[model samples]
Target: MDNMKQLIKQFSALITLSLILTGCVSLPEPIYLTDEEVSIAAKVGITEQQYRVIKTSQLYQLSPRQTDQYLRILHEQEPDLRKRIGRIAEKNIGQPYELYLLGEAPFEPYDSQPLFELSKSDCVVFVEHTYAMGLTDNWGDFFKTLQHIRYNNGEVGVVTRNHFTEYDWNRNNNWLVEDISSIAGENTIKTYEQTINKERFFAKQFGINVPQDNVKTVETYVPNEHIPAVAQYLQTGDFVNLVRSTGKGAWVGHVGIIKVEDNGKVNVIHSASPAVRKEGLLEMAKSFLAETPERFAEGRTATVGFKVLRLHETANDNLKAKFDGNVPPIMMLNRKYEYLTKEQVKTKLALMREQAKKDLIENALEQSKQSDIK
Candidate 1:
């Protein structure tokens, strides 16, 4: 205790900025630091006094407890993989809700990095964590597998972040997801161009001023009227990404795995705004429209096009492994101190922004061909 204070007094000018840049540590201001906190800060090169916003961050952790029965079903006896996925979500019912998880740096517009926090999570984080847990029994492999699923080409950086439910991840990770949308099938489905407000979205998340050309529009779906047909085909363990209106923020508003009840009722087990929870697929759709009647005018509403995706057995087999329940000791830290390529950043950013224009142009060209025939 005296040793920590002495170091603090000696290096009074050194602020928490150093620790903040590295990752998370204790004490931003000149205050008493506990032995554990002091050790962590010292190990990470974080110590100083200033405006402190310190709190416990629950990431890259094993669950509070993984029951033997849960383990047996998930890792051993469960014959059906979908049921296994639902069971994994069932184990994590009461975990707390955490937001701004990816934004943990001293500098503004916290750079993007692959974060694997399982103790607590928000909606999408909940789904990602559950999937990781369900797949890997070992924490180390879980972190590696998570990186494989969360980024492009399994590379880590701010620009490599994959958030889009329809295009970004769905396009890249064929091993993890099977696209059941109209494009992948022979059937013709209703589709529309969603103009992504990149400026508004990035400004809010990354705190960056984006160019007009950076905004993208892509051919996506509302699926307001067709959720039932889609839901019928969905089974347990299916990854359901609720693509909502752009006015809200990002394209994916909610995410969860499908759970079929004993009585044959199908529900979405997800973590939402208030907390992590489950809802009947039909009920979820009804509530979305009811909450904002003006958004749809007068019509039936379901989750912003419910992106029903199925996980392949090969991916699941590779991801799910035996666990010793040990925390991964080594992780790539010092992300805030690292630099990312601008061209790669812009290329990734522009890919998201321009999807809509390309779709619209193609649609127009098709219409013109029909007009000539008439």
Candidate 2:
């Protein structure tokens, strides 16, 4: 009887252990975004061109090999569009312009087509109409209209008249230029002059800014020539954004900026890379930013940096005090004014860094827990 009791107790203990092990084994595994996720991120909108690509490639029903081929073709075609637009810009560099189409291309069908392809004629008409109304829609035409323009020479004009009412010429170009020039030195024009300076241009072009600091700063193991000048604007506690270029050629393929974090590990906030939505540091850096380990190392070696400027106050203040405010008061000062105190910026940076560290740890633990369950 005693032996039997002991045997029964042992059996119970074994069963309990087995149950626990089974429970552990049954836990769910964490899911990470795959190449599909990255591909989804790359999608900008349901443009007509995208629809055409999708339908032509039969991506929805494609085999793995076919899908891969389709993606390759899409990537190859992206630069061709840019080249065509740049050719157009170059040809019309000095002309007082109106929108022109290469020829009468049929308007893409509305249902399956992307809205961007409403009509090539419509796009040209929009540009011409805006120009006539005294509004310059240069960036819109350049960046948005990719289909009608060919790879060869095409010309478009800048609006010279001030009589139009539909577009706000003063608000669009003159006011911002005057305002930025007033705050920044006159040389700002030579350095940062581009179509991107337009407010609508940047806002429409990019997505929402994350809740954290508009900018982030990071230190790389390698020497980056672009850092010192930008660093002057950063405070020790302030977060600074970062962007690094990726691609085999001279062009930058991928760009993202670092968000604030407490741990030494960098946290990035970006859209449409290896993953579509916003992600934490490890996933983002490991997946999208550093897709190729060799390329990542090479980028680290080159060390191009970035910082976001979400709010205009600090940037504007820095520009005013450093470049605009004091004339001849401080001779031998660097042409780029250094006015903000390090402490003011540092406080914000420290908070951001701490938040980042916590986020990373949470992400790791979650991943581990999920794996254990699986």
Candidate 3:
């Protein structure tokens, strides 16, 4: 009996060892910097510890802890928010492109996706994460800011999420950026209005019910042929929405950030199906217009124009004020919580989401009552 018990214990130990060796199990381990890594860290003017953490993760050479530290470094090195945004995004140039990368996971049962993803990103996730990271120096603040950018009034749910590009995302984030598509020059622009039925969109895409109908009225864009003229006005860190034409209707199909070169050239950096990459604005426009019928058959849409947004001059200062406990309750949590464990965060966020939903519904009811009284 004793030998049999010992044999079982040995077997269990071996199985656990195998799982750990094969990367099936994760355990926190101390990070040790090698001599070469230490040298490189010194050469780069960062501590060996910081470099070690940065190298541990493949996502833009930054682990979560490294991101917090690096953000501070970036802020110190570059005071200009627009240039900083471009620089931060450039670090993730080779990140793998993915679709539907984020959802409210562990916080709510609506979507099984996690709160954040570092290694891979879709166009929207890439833009949101980059902007969030650019604006904050820690994981907690980044997470909060990302939610603020992603959802209307910073509510966490499928119903409140900014699913539509022009109607929801652009409108909600107007404080951070301004739609300057019309300012790209009158001759270089086109205008169109898109009706967005969020009621149908939520039902079809997410299997959720939302009692809302929305519209993107009178959106201006610069057509692909006029990109050269439009590109002249584009500055670094400008938001770009790629407009796709289906011959029936149009939508902002993809999103990217504009990077202006020292040599006076404009570039669009985006994450597409294969991976993240940078392309000159004029060349990208030409390529889009040059798509073959075979490419279209393979599920590629023609990018007909671009809706551009410029960063607000006071965006960084405004964000800082919010971070400093001067935020409105509707826009943020109104108070900062210290670093929280995953489980604690999950519980708190779940409650917050429920509260936000209730608040929204009550506010709508109150508005309806006022209208009836009038």
Summed backbone clashes in each candidate are 14, 30, 0
What's the residue-level lDDT of 196 in candidate 1?
47
lDDT of 1 by residue, 1-374 (tens): 99999998768645566776677665555456566555544443335221011212112223423222223323543556566678777766667777755532232235643265556677767776666656765555566666666666555544455656555666666667776655334342445444445444554456454444433445544364566556666777778777766344336666788898888788988876666677898777666656655665644333455667787766754333312333233233434322335665576557655875787699999999999999
Q: Give the TM-score of candidate 3.
A: 0.71
RMSD of 3: 12.7
After superposition on all C-alphas, the RMSD of every candidate to the true structure, in Å, is 14.4, 28.5, 12.7
- The sequence of per-residue lDDT tens digits that candidate 3 reaches over residues 1-374 is 99999999999999999999999997788798767656656655678767665655545556676777666556655777788888878888889988998887666665688878888899999999888877776667777788888987677766677888998899888868889887756887888778776654554455554555344476888888888777888899899999987554678989999999899889888999788788899998888767734556776667888899988767656655655745433232222213345565456546656866896699899999999999
Best by lDDT: 3
TM-score of each: 0.59, 0.21, 0.71
Model 2, poorest ten-residue lDDT window?
Answer: 150-159
Candidate 2 vs candidate 3: the TM-score winner is 3
Whose TM-score is higher: candidate 1's or candidate 3's? Answer: 3
Residue 308 in model 2: shift from native, Å? 4.4
- As a TM-score, model 1 comes out at 0.59
